[model samples]
Target: MSLQVRIMTPDRIFLNEEAEEIILPTNTGQMGVLKNHAPLITALDIGVMLIRSKNEWTPLALMGGFALVKQNQVTVLVNEAESAETIDPNEVENSFTIAKTKLEQAEGQKQKVEANFVFKRERARYQVIKQAKKM
Candidate 1:
């Protein structure tokens, strides 16, 4: 049997399907989930989430949130999520470059934190697009 995966944002449900495997970017690190995996909860980071179904991998840019895995069901609730197909590579590349610059030039602690957050978010999007192109 496959795992039931559901990804949601505040506005709407991003994905509701079955995936053979899932790799989540958690606060600790990357965590892999599969069918019949033990129940657990994890805090997601601003990074890429990979879902594998039918031996094909799909990537999604996921913002910070929490995930719950129980009884072969994986539920992800994030602040924002974007599929690679919906993102523009050119726009993401430009934003990633700008965010990197801002992060490097940030002075105060608050500015540094904010810049870092933006940088990570853009970087995640950039990574998702890059991964998609490779597939």
Candidate 2:
């Protein structure tokens, strides 16, 4: 059996994937979902969600949001989402570096915001890059 996943953002719908299993990036940590798992609605961490289909795994980066799971269907509504094909290693690395620098020099609320964004983006980079290597 499989499940339904719809990943959306303010700009557009990033994905509507169907798979045998899903690995979510929860704020607490990673959580795995399979058919008939308990119903849940939980926060999504800034990381990656791996989709398993036909014995193949597809990985995509995700930002904070919420996921609603009931029965065997999971709707992933995220703040931001990106596929491996869409991520640029150089760009992600630069963003991570800039965020780190801002954190070090952070002195105000604005700096804190920048630092948070950096952390979120860097987490995506790490997840996607690791998936790329495995594939």
Candidate 3:
């Protein structure tokens, strides 16, 4: 098994433990890190990190982050990570609608920022929805 694994966000560190493997949503795509994985670090996209341990796949919603795998330890410093099961479908859907409308009306830098925020939130929400379908 891998020695240690951590998934951290600015607000909290959701998980930390020894795991058999971790599947991350890299900027490029999804990839798995096993024990003694080749030393490498990469950026994470807004997607799911499927942590494999305890004979189960734990879905971690990562908005963005960087991952480091070394010496059988994997650490993911993410901007966000939320359990898909805990998310309320209505919340995600409502947020998406608000974000889409703001994005559609964006006209200036400040407006654009709002739009971007919405986009990110909606994307994360959609990811949760998609991952929920898998479970």
Candidate 4:
């Protein structure tokens, strides 16, 4: 049996399908869920979410959110998400560089906080590209 996985964003549902395994970047660390694994809920971080089905892996860059696993079903609700296949490597690298610069030049606390979020998002996208290349 496979797990019913659903990934959603604010605007709409991003993915709805079956997956052999699901990996989420939780606040504590990466958590892997399989069919009939467990019942739990956890906070997710800005990172990559990997889904494996039929020996193929798909990577998605996710922003901060939460995940719930119950009854062999996994639901991921995130603020934003992007598929690794759709990301432009050069664009991601450029955004990462720009975000780093903005973070460094951010003077006020609010600016720093916003810039940090952007930096984290870009970093996750970069990591997603790298991770997808391996698969």
Tell me each candidate's TM-score: 0.99, 0.86, 0.76, 0.91
- Candidate closest to the true structure, highest lDDT: 1
lDDT by residue (1-135, candidate 3, tens digit) is 455998888988778888787788787888988887888989988776777777777676788889988888888898877887778877888877888888988998998986886687577766767766776
Model 2: how far residue 68 lies from native, Å = 0.5
lDDT of 2 by residue, 1-135 (tens): 679878889899888868899999898999999989899999988888898988989888887899999978898888788887888877877777777777778889987887877777786876687787797
Stronger candidate by lDDT (1 vs 4): 1
What C-alpha lDDT does candidate 2 achieve relative to the native structure? 0.84
Error of 3 at 110 (Å): 5.6
Q: Comparing 1 and 4 by TM-score, which wins? A: 1
Candidate 3 overall lDDT versus native: 0.79
Q: What is the lDDT of residue 45 in candidate 2?
A: 83
TM-score of 1: 0.99
How does candidate 4 score on lDDT? 0.93
- Candidate 2 Cα misplacement greater than 4 A, ranges: 108-110
Ranking by TM-score: 1, 4, 2, 3
Which stretch of 10 consecutive residues in model 1 shows the poorest summed lDDT?
81-90
